[model samples]
Target: MQAPERIMSCERPDSEEFCYFLAKDYFRFVLDGSESQPAANNVVETLRRSGSSLDRSGRELEHCINKLNLSSIEEVERVLPSLMREIYSDGIDNWGRIVTLYAFCGVLVSNLKKKGVPERELIEGVAQCLAQYTWTHKAAWIKENGGWEKGFVEHFQEKKNSHFYTKIAAFTGIVAAFSFVIYQH
Candidate 1:
């Protein structure tokens, strides 16, 4: 079967986008466990100090994910390698940076939603943005907390055609490949 759709597609702010955004945020923080409250707090403090004027509490979330070294949808495609290395370090074998970027996109969409923007449109925007980086090096990412299969299945249930689903599938594949490679050593 087709593994599933990747989340990069849902980076757009179209209809049904919120479903993906919420699912993305849910997976990163709740499932992936890379997002901590301290990171959220750092984001809030940074925005407040920088006077970014982003009013939603979700902005803190956005800031935190970005700080984790995830790229913003606005980032150019060429800069991803450096960005990924900065976040994942030598574990570049595991596409942790890319995963974090997807997670960050989810947060950005949610932030827009909290700021009174239409959830669907914001989510679609996120998906569209992700579609750009849809082909980042295809490396495996560390499982850190949980396995990708369980997380992807739980996060992308009936939403099979969505960007979130696609991302989960791709993420799972990447992580699985990495695990296989490590096992061979």
Candidate 2:
């Protein structure tokens, strides 16, 4: 199958509102992140079955998560590398580094979960790698790239140093939820 298209627009994933929306709507009860394809479909079906009983916010959130959920793991896996490339893109003055990094963090979390790995270990490892990469190596790239400041400024304005750390917390929640759903089956 053809690779899924990348999200070309640059947006930060640091918003608590966005994270909460993702947490409640997208990753809420993912019992089997590894069985992501079927599990995602099931979750979407569950949401669809719930239908208009949902409020406007609930419906919108459900729809967004449904979009993320319906995509196959094979498709997600195929696009992972390309997503990484965009994170490390050259010459484009891309300010979406942190946003891309956060998204990649989510994908990596999902990938590891789907691999049937331990939830804590998977999320912790990826979060550490991301922190190290951003502070050491990626920091240099940001200094050279003009677009970095915009992303950083916008990302931190909401909650100071919390965004980076908060992502890991959010990821852990999703992974834990995935594990819980798996154990229930």
Candidate 3:
């Protein structure tokens, strides 16, 4: 069991190869409550601004998730894939979109956690779902883009224009909102 799970997790290889673990770990960083959640924290720290601070981003993210109105796991299952399809409708070329996907997963986990989904079940289920997305939708892209290695990291942090912050704002909103939603339920 653990062996299969370790397979699902992203481990750095000696060579540049596509690894699904990067996506799972990014999601798990939230689901498993790991102390270092660089996906969210890094973006939040980079885009820290008044009225759009980390705390505020969470509240705003809560508002965005509320707009989705996902009250049940069934609804989450039915709707999230569709939302994901729409989210990646263009392409996963930019860091903002990738972060938005991260934010989206964060929102779903928050929903599940709020609805009292068991922790082990939630982690396994979400990891599997993300793994599906990893192999199906984004594997080639991850391989081409840098597989969370120098390529992805370099692109992710380079804030070249003002529009980047807008994306950061949206992503942060999703990240910060989870805890509030989780506790409320």
Number of the top lDDT candidate: 3
**Per-residue lDDT of model 3, residues 23-136, tens digit only:** 345445555544454433222333222112233344555565776666555666666565555555545355455555555566567666877876556555555555566557
Ranking by TM-score: 3, 2, 1
TM-score of each: 0.32, 0.33, 0.61
Give candidate 2 regions above 4 Å deviation: 1-89, 140-185
Residues 73-105 of candidate 2 have per-residue lDDT tens digits of 444344433434443443332333344344434
Best by TM-score: 3
Show pairs that collide, candidate 2: 31-181, 31-182, 34-114
Model 1: worst 10 consecutive residues (lDDT sum): 46-55
Candidate 1 residue-wise lDDT, 96-123, digit = tens: 2344455544555555455565554544
Positional deviation of residue 149's Cα in model 1 after best superposition, in angstroms: 6.4
Between 1 and 2, whose TM-score is larger? 2
The local distance difference test score of each candidate is: 0.36, 0.37, 0.50
